[model samples]
Target: MSSDRQPIPPTRPTGHQIIAPGHTFATVSDKISSIVLTRRTPLYWFIPFLIASALLMVFLVAVTALLVRGVGLWGIKVPVMWAWAITNFVWWIGIGHAGTLISAILLLLRQSWRNSINRFAEAMTLFAVACAGMFPLLHLGRPWLFYWLFPYPNTMNVQPQFRSPLVWDVFAVSTYATVSALFWYVGLIPDLATLRDRARNRGARIIYGILAMGWRGAASHWQKYETASLLLAGLATPLVLSVHTVVSFDFTIAILPGWHSTIFPPYFVAGAIYSGFAMVLVLAIPLRAMYGLQDLITMRHLDNMAKVMLATGEIVAYSYIFEAFISWYSGDKYEMFAMWNRMTGPYAVTYWTLIFCNLVFPQILWVKKIRTNVVWLFIVSVDVLVGMWLERYVIIVVSLHRDFLPSSWGIFHPTIWDVATYVGTLGLFFFLFFLFIRGLPMISIFEVRTLLPQAEVAEVEQ
Candidate 1:
């Protein structure tokens, strides 16, 4: 290893400095690229990969059984038609929100701290979206006919109902996926070129060379890369808010008691961001430790992420209060009953657990010590993820189980298959993420290099 590429001493960053002192352009590039290039595949990497792969098999088996035995294998009965699947769908979608917010919005704001973590965060977004997308298709009964949801010309002349928010999700998610993939790939071109040039193996160089598209680090290439990145960032900025808002419409447009509320849009978006940041911390904390990248992903990054979680958690808490208030103030007996049932009914445990998880536990982040502690941050992040999932469960299952007419009311229980399927998706997510870490630069090499003192001087001189 080159002397310049040596790891920085493990030291906690003081104040809000993004990167530690003593890093140069070469150090930044070499340090990040080495993870994907020259480093030996550590034993720890395979341990989780094997576990995730085992879970992935569970997902495949569950999916195959669903296809063979039908959606009846799930707990979806008459009144409780939407259960674990929809809850998992919404939760996964919400988890994806932080990536776009961190990568696009922060980039536009010129926040340099995002450079270290945005690559993996963006990958998380794509992977989460991929996981979320699977449920709607499986929920369609005929999983093979999912393309019918699209407004394509066909012989049957079947068109998706334009008024239905489910149909709206078809377009919204597809658009979000396309734009996110483009943005992610566009960002990777420079890094791909870096890998291509540095790889010792012939096959690795060829594969990366194809992905790099002949990027030569020219002045003109940099200008075009900057312009394209800015334009994509501009386009993606609105998607951070719009996609989840459209998702909320799936419930809001309904006349069902808990479902029909104006506040759902903003409420859902805030919750999405809240859960999304928690996931970033969950992924970041372990990754930094395992790779000995404390200097690169400093305490400053963890602090900022915790602060974001705190802010969004507060918004979600207020939304909960306001939701209850509106139900009482409007004197809507059905809405009131929905809220009452969530508190006192059979599923009340989930509701209260979510309350403590999303609202109560996260309040500890207000303390600077907790925000900077990696172990506490990981615990809080896991708590938030659970809280967010239960939040969806309360919103979907609890609300649907007991309608105004008692005759039609029914309890929704998640069968073994439902648990299997949900757990399977978790496996799928981690499996893809593990593959990503091994194959690509998890941090943006060129972007982080720009944060070096010499690069700043070069920019000024130019």
Candidate 2:
């Protein structure tokens, strides 16, 4: 190769040379505050908030009726005791897992792309978990005694059964929720401080300042914050795995033929991520458009997320196939019958819907053109979420409807309360998410700014 044609050596910056004037870290703090805080909240913010609030009121009314009247108002009966309540519980919990996976797991993996979305995803996780935690408690007809699920000294001298998967669910979900909140709040400290400084009024400043916990941009503070975050991430990874594993156990450990399975742990985890990411995309697309964050939450971010959705979609497909193979290989007549029932029996419509939504629609993402198209990505994400919900319904309802005893075989249906609450939960999730976006930064300003290429080069030169 000619000398001029040879690869040019990378230029090295000299020490203490000013690349640009007034480039202090404080400037970054100010820029972020300006982007997030507004003089008055936008009208678009009120739409989700109002709708969510209205739905939440309806949920309260329905729940009160359930408490006053009893579980009889629900569609639950013999051989179908577990209906929409448990389905909603599991589905919401699964959706909750996505936020932690994006925020904690990807952070440890050093996936730089996570910087743009992790904060909001973390918030989504917290709110989803909050919405999810309600179902298990309320599913107990007497919500008053729901606390008995926890281990504490009781007059009956009975301890919560450690052997029961439901108890395990109690512990796992509680731990996951608590740890996720701490992690999300800890990450927000620096950004909150930025807000504290930028607040136009004394009340807002005081509120943000207190929440900031006296955070300063000192090197020592960042070091400790990062170390704490890393430790929390380590703690959170296994917690995430165990939480969903326990959820799977709730079904798998049952003696019902269709419920028993060895493949549930990984399968459930993959499904959780798949649905969680779908919710993230659904929320992100709207927020990006609403907040004028198109540049920060860019097409590149959507493309990367679509790739993840497609990969997990395939994993779920594999789980579906493996379930079929195992059911056939076991040669248990009841198991085979249960599988057959799902495909061609009473609820075949729901079964086909699951396949079409979860397995087929996601395949579109395999096309590079489809993955990058914002409208297509949004549509596919919504489709995947619906499919995942149906998948959970299929697993729970189908298995329970036709357990070992042929005499117990029956079809289950949901009542108006069931549909109302499901819609209400969606409202709750979006309501919390809307508040988070309008009141706090939807994108992680600190993390995104750090991802700028110039900042990376500057850090290296230093």
Candidate 3:
């Protein structure tokens, strides 16, 4: 490690200081603020931001065409009624789960390391949900009539098919999005106040001031803030399970052979968290280097997150084995064929690719050096994302493509629009993230302050 990486303090252990030594409360604030206020956007950030912007334009044009021409522009048809759009929806929703795990679940469990990473993780969650939320709305063929999915007083007097899993999806995703946004914004309040206090210009001062909502960092204010955060964490923990479980319901509730298993709920939830942690590492490694955040987000954090990826990935691997085993064990030929088709059918390459991506690659993480190394960790993270996506493709498209009647079997191919919409959401996610890094304190300033040794000594004295 370079000297710039971190200078160890004599009193502090290798893992201590969560924030490096030699930082006071003011310095912590200054350090994070310098990233946003003092530093110019580096070429590293600018190039990706520019690319994301260009892709956002492609997304807009693609979506406009989708609305104008209807669902026919995509390759979705009879046997593969739900294809790329639903796959992307599930994939994005899964990616969002790590945010909730880091922010809500770990907070409840009293993981102090979560402090440095949770702010950005929560932001990623909100954006991932945004990307996830778009697909189902667009899937509503007429989309303009999507409000009909809600309960409303109407002359026709129809309500959403309350029992349908897709309806459950509407409720689950919307509730998750709402809670995630609220949770993220509430966490931002204290940091926003920091920005407000430090603002050099009137415009920024006023904008951040308004958003700060009179937070003066008083004892009473902090008491109320902590109380609100605990309550929100309680609410959000269930959502971490509920949102993806309901998403899995979109498949398990069906009579389709591969989709009908009871294991789908936990299986999907594990996969969601699995992919989410991967994405966080994927984003964090590059970011830690670019923004010089290695000290704050240390190798310890990387090692821990990599351990999480390996463990949850093992669960996902179990689900894969059980899915195959149960399909073969059951006397149902349809179930048998769905499993076989996934392994040996027309899209066999995708199924095998998914296995390699999800299973083969993550095995490298068990080697301690690789898990702790950014380059190796980043490669594995990208593979996890690809594998999880291919997992969705296998589940939705492969199962649907070869169901029931032999005569009806057909393959689903994404049109330019399908590919564009998925890529566009990536563009949008990156764009939002770039804006986030630019405007806000990416680390929780107050939380990191709490980790300082002096704060702990003060608490002990009190």
TM-score list, all predictions: 0.95, 0.92, 0.95
Give the 10-residue window scoring lowest on summed lDDT in candidate 3: 6-15
Q: Write the per-residue lDDT of candidate 2 for residues 185-287, one digit (tens) a residue.
A: 9989888988897888788899999999898879877767777887898899999989999999999998887788989999999999999999899988887
Best by lDDT: 1
What TM value does model 3 have? Answer: 0.95
- Ranking, TM-score, top scorer first: 1, 3, 2
Looking at model 2, residue 397 earns an lDDT score of 92
Model 1 local distance difference test score: 0.91
Per-residue lDDT of model 1, residues 1-462, tens digit only: 235853321111122357788888788888888998999999889999999999999999999999999999999998999899999999999999999998899888777788889999999999999999989888889999888888888899778899899898989999999999999999999999999999999999999999999999998777677878888888998987999999999999988899999999999999999999999999999999998889889998999999999999999999999998999897989999999999999999999999999989899999999999999999999999999999999999999999889999998878999999999999999999999999999988887776665553222454
Per-candidate clashes, comma-separated: 0, 0, 0
Q: How many backbone clashes does candidate 3 have?
A: 0
Over the stretch 1-462, how does candidate 3's per-residue lDDT look in tens digits?
A: 246843432122223546677777888889898787777778998999999999889889888998999988889999998999999999999999999999999888777788889999998998999988889888888888888988899999777789999898888999999999999999999889999988887998999999999889998777677878888999999988999999999999999988998999999999999999999999899889989888789888899899999999999999999999999999799999999999999999999999999988899999999988899999999999999999999999999998889999998888889999889999999999989999998888888877777664432454
Candidate 1 accuracy as TM-score: 0.95
Overall lDDT per candidate, in order of appearance:
0.91, 0.83, 0.89
